[model samples]
Target chain A: MKSTLLLGTRKGLVVYRHQNGQWAMQDVHFPGVPVSIAYADERNGVWWACLDHGHWGVKLHRSADRGANWEEVTAPAYPEGAEIKPGEPAHTRYLWAMQQGGRRHPDRLWVGTEPGGLFRSDDGGREFQLVESLWNHPSRENNWFGGGRDHAGIHSVVVDPRDENHVYVGVSCAGVFESVDAGKTWAVRNKGLRADFLPDPEAEVGHDPHLLVASPANPDVMWQQNHCGIFRSVDGGRLWTDISEKDGPASFGFAIAVADDDPDQAWVAPAVSDMHRLAIDRSLCVCRTDDGGKSWKTLRHGLPQGHSFDIVYRHALACSGDGLAFGTTTGNLFFSADRGERWQVINNYLPMVHSVLFVE
Target chain B: MPSVNFTYALKRFFPDLREIDLKAESLSDLLAQLEKKHPGLRAYVLDEQGRLRRHVNIFIDGELIADRDALTDPFRPDSEIYIMQALSGG
Candidate 1:
């Protein structure tokens, strides 16, 4: 299991290190800044922090030597003459998702942003260029709308470890899109997703997938915590099946994590539906499915029970080996060493954790 | 040459920030000159489309510039250009 946890919070990038059977606060970067995403590129041991400045727009920073020092790099920018709508110009409002290009391309980096744009960097994030193929797709203009944000945003990027050329991005209010030729061309893959908010629930490109993840051992098995419910795809997202609990708290949530070694095993943080974004029954719990979502077991050991309003964000929940961790909107961080059987509170005064990442 | 000033908030990112006088024609030209002096400073003040950032303001002699999109606001040779961040409540 990874020993370090990098937390992107509303206040700053908080890092905690587990040493000698105890976790301690190590360092804080970008003090008093809203770090939307805290990512560690395990391939090259580089740490990245995506900042969402309320007054100065979005920014990106990278640190090669752990957290000792950092260097500001050019954040992805929309090209000139680009527009979100006919009259509204397109600029990078937020950096929601980031992934390193697989082992084949050491210098490649991918970044997904709000207002619906994808960017690629060929030189290890020194500079980034917008991927025009997906941006200029036919359905982006009319079909893609906002879910949680005012404009559509890409929040998930899954790169097939088998082939770096095969890329997948999950967009809010736009469903899933796949690229076979390394982002040169794209196609929608929302065959079974249901967008209940749309006029047509089965629309091809307007589904909201809050977070998408594929099992590391079996790349073909993809799972998403969607706006409607939990969905699973057995054949690389070509088709999806709703596996949400019919009469349980596992029906609605934002974050989901699949075991790296088991495609059939996954966990989800359950909350009340869209109408009420609070902990189900005012109690916090994580639901686990070890048999491919056929059934779910709510794990409440060592978690808050009764009168709790904590709900995890889409990017806050993560799992590595036998360790699992998640941060809540109400500034609580919990970790479990034995899957989701039991959890321990790591902190209680964090500043609305945005993303929680485990790094070796 | 008009003297250019920046908000102290920017000093957090660009620690070397200081008052400087530069020779330029318009607000756009002045910004370009400022960019040369302080790398990556223009992006903090302007968006990708070269428009003034929504929360950032550039005032020429205590008055807000009228042309935010084109940045065509004019200033005298000895004018004091104040680049400030708007006080939107946190």
Candidate 2:
């Protein structure tokens, strides 16, 4: 039972090592930069690395031995006077997500930023602060936007293994947010979801959740992959239900995986929307749902069925143990011990994959 | 008294950095004395509202320094400085 894989790349963090059954490449941590997210807190062994030094900004590294050695901490900034607007200019432009603080906060650590912020760390990941009632909330300047750069950016940080004070976040155009006393306060869970460019496409908070998963057996059940499609929220998120037409009719994708014990199981890798991000006719499948989304199959025996122009992000898929691992933007690397219906590419060159974890 | 240097593509991420020798007289006091001797190199050369970080640039003896937002250039005393990181022109 030795399964480990942590790849957050553009060029760094890589460590795959699934013993005797195959998978190799052992180490390579933050070697060149761009690792937008990487956490390996196997409960407490600690190792969180989120660096995105493109011209320098956003850094946070910490490794208490497991990763051999590393330091640099104080990342999520914006404090001293932090108010902005009078020309506007604050920072934190990267760290898309990193969550590991449950069982009643074992030294908490929850970061998610870009333009959207939410920091928190109680000493385990070293030092972090900025939670500021969901960063001052006040409907954050007309609901938030910038899909990945200039504004909205909280790339999914769901924690609620049955209420560790419960918490959830997911934004990329802003939608899905919750906090049950743990983060001081926050609300707006985007009811049924949708924002066909807004103007009231169910707008409650801009809507654009790209990918968000829960159901590690059932953390009150949640699942989303939106921008205008796939959604499900069984109550923990207040309300939501529109399984993207049960995974077809062009549902788009940015990755999502569940099934830590099957809250009905799930997975998605579709794509061919959001203005053709690729794969779908260029053929590359991976949409599976186990009676939960009502129906969806398309796994494609070992995957990649044609021309292929891969694209998968949103922490690059990932469901551990009995199998599922993903990475691609073209750097390839696949694995599936069956739950994804046969697959195994493992590594093609190793680069451009931003986030994929499974450390068991 | 100025010397400064730093730009071999930022030695991976400031590997000790080089050409130092600063007495400082602006350019934000040699970047606050190069971040009091390089701890994060003033966030790789200014940002988080302190400005100067579009891709970074800080020449002096060879010219380039139009005050990328309050850097206030002016250090001449054997003046050199450099610091660059453009990587490619537009």
Candidate 3:
């Protein structure tokens, strides 16, 4: 059996699949405002989700039998009471990005957080230990806290599937950070990127990348939808290039996704600008760039002609082998079976839909 | 001696009183006084060592004093002691 696509929303998580060739909404859990990321491991048969229990805070939940039953999992406390001292204002720690780690001898799970930190879990999704080296890194505070929302503030941790220790983390206000030696040390990779026209230039973290996807086929390659435009790093984020301009249907929201089968044939979810707000307009269309961004094509057929209220959030876009799909901020779900050439509104009723995933 | 103010969450349990403006001195005294009057208010306030537990957040005149070790948080007479359940998660 294949894994199902799980859509984690502000309300909860919903898993759906094509039944009789129809995308059907399955079981959903309203764990308050669930976080952006959700994991379903077919290898070990474990399904886990980090619920962003807003107003209340954040929590981790696990369902071993694929959405059949769920149980509350507390934050696995450090064995010897964490030595983390309060930073100026207060002791506020929150989890942001989470991934089911690669199957190695030790078996590890990784988690990224706000206030900009990372944690690892060895026992599936059970307990976690703060990656001390990354957290205590001299430049971590500068990379993490220096720029707040200007860089979306600490998210998008991409782990190399071939190697568990080899990691690349994206920090807000901090461009691209890579850790070669497990999670011990991290260095900012902002070579070919340009800093904004600010007093503190690096304030916006050169080229403020919004969404990042490492090419599954070639781990050395990664593409990003930045505040400026789209770029790809063939040498694992060392260098970059501009693939868009101030001309045609360009960017605003960081909505980019790569096809799991063909990494080069990826899609860019278009938005309005670098202003960092979701303003919907019918002109917004998902741009597809084949031949690795040498040229592009805009998919605008069968969609709203003018002033459509469908805005895709940074985390609101997803893709499967069958096709690409995204949910609107106005609670409309649409899916396109033919890559990104066309679309159809599959489900029109959701809680101002945050994101949609077409589970296999 | 100053008094303590219960936040909206604490007020949920102690509906009779609006705030815990007690004449007690220490945190234990104030929470004990609230417990004495409101029965389960102490259980909702402190966990064990009179330390503000995970759920409860004690702010003396808007300053958060959740540190557990020294417990040397001082308050002046009529210092507004606000003890509320700080919802954590999400």
Candidate 4:
């Protein structure tokens, strides 16, 4: 089988092809546009790129034939002449994340944006309507403002594989939220999460979740790498249990990956917390948990052992097939085939990688 | 007909829009006509309410436009309009 990797970067989206046991850069899409996220829906043969022009706001583009050609879609926009409630944002800032619906519902798409809003699309990826229920929730003003530039952002969108309507979203600085009825209404799902920065560490909605992923083998079981600590939930995000005690160092990196067939397995890159946010001791180590975060082993074989200052971002680490791959802020890529027990550098240098996704 | 030109920085997004001569009496009119020729260009320069984007600047001839709200600043038929990104992002 052939594998293609899509990397969203600070400058653009880079595509690499792996064949004959070698990897090479295949294409660069949206050369000068800052891509916050790049997603390839292999099931539908469609690609979506979230471009943040900064001066022009964020827009969505669609490519029908992989990444060969592209056309801009009707971007999610707030209606004209809308009355501004005191708390609602005056205008959209940036489109931070996007995730297509489950296998049973291919036509549905969920989008997250800065200023912390959710938008849903029913017609593939052409048009979108704002999820007003989540946007207008009263807690947004107080909870969603710290992680992003000037406002909060939704960086993780996970759709439950077992149920089409059950969805999950992670907001930076605002914690995790779940929508049981297809995004019509939402509730704060941070029961056992912690926000140590706040006066109350157990607040319901102000915690910062860096990344969240559901186990393919068991959708009810999920893992999260948060600003404060690493957490796990077994009952569909109703409650969380901090598991960072076993995760050595500070347990403070941004990326997390889980095995497809083994819900008890997961991978994370640990970094120094507090003022310095780089790899611990300038050494790169990826921690793997075989007993579902109960215990973790640091994987360093074939990886950098000295002077490593890599800060992996959320969405950069992905579990592809039987392999685990992730990129770093220093523009290096690593891949492991035996569940992160060992690693090899696939690409040493590229633009700052925002996302690294594997398409089989 | 007024002469319109964009800074080299915008060439990445608008490849064929380095220079053009068009008939327009005001900046707003020129932007509308420009959008008709190159789709999605207006949204980058103007907001949803048609106000000039905060990070975009327009100068009529050698002077900056005074009316950003309605863009009613009149220009001569042969005036040269210059559009460039605001210096903030740089």
DockQ scores of the candidates: 0.84, 0.23, 0.09, 0.49
- Determine which window of 10 residues in candidate 4 chain A has minimal summed lDDT: A81-90
* Candidate 1 global TM-score: 0.99
What TM-score do all the candidates reach, one by one? 0.99, 0.38, 0.77, 0.92
Clashes of each: 0, 0, 12, 0
lDDT of 3 by residue, B5-71 (tens): 6667544334687754568667666667767777655534443224455555678888988464335
Per residue, candidate 3 scores C-alpha lDDT tens digits across A18-125 of 777677777787544654556665457676676654333456678878788876665433323333344232122445566656666345777766555577777766
Per-residue alpha-carbon lDDT of candidate 2 for residues A1-360, written as tens digits (9 for 90 to 100): 238888889778888888889989999987877797888876777778898877767788888786888888778777755643435676787889888878567888888887788888887766788898887888876677788467888888888877777788998887888888888988898987778988899978888888788898778889887867778887777898887654364277888788788877788888888886888888777888887788888787777777889888878888875789889888898998978888989887877898888875
- DockQ of model 3 vs. true complex: 0.09
Ranking by TM-score: 1, 4, 3, 2
Preferred candidate (lDDT higher): 3 or 4: 4
Show pairs that collide, candidate 4: none
Regions of model 3 farther than 4 Å from truth: A1-3, A31-33, A76-86, A89-94, A146-152, A200-207, A276-281, B1-90
Residue-wise lDDT of candidate 4 within A48-119, one digit each (tens)?
898888677677899988887898887777655432346332456677778888778778898887767788
Compose the digit string of candidate 1's lDDT tens values, residues B1-90: 899898999999889999998889988888888788889989999999999999999999999999989998888999999999999764
lDDT of 3 at A185: 82
Query: How far does residue A52 in candidate 4 sit from its true spot (Å)?
Result: 2.0
- List the lowest-lDDT window of 10 residues for candidate 4 chain B: B81-90
Lowest lDDT sum, 10 consecutive residues, model 3 chain B, at: B43-52
Judged by DockQ cut-offs, is candidate 1 incorrect, acceptable, medium or high? high
Model 4 regions lying over 4 Å from their true place: A81-89, B18-26, B49-51, B65-79, B87-90
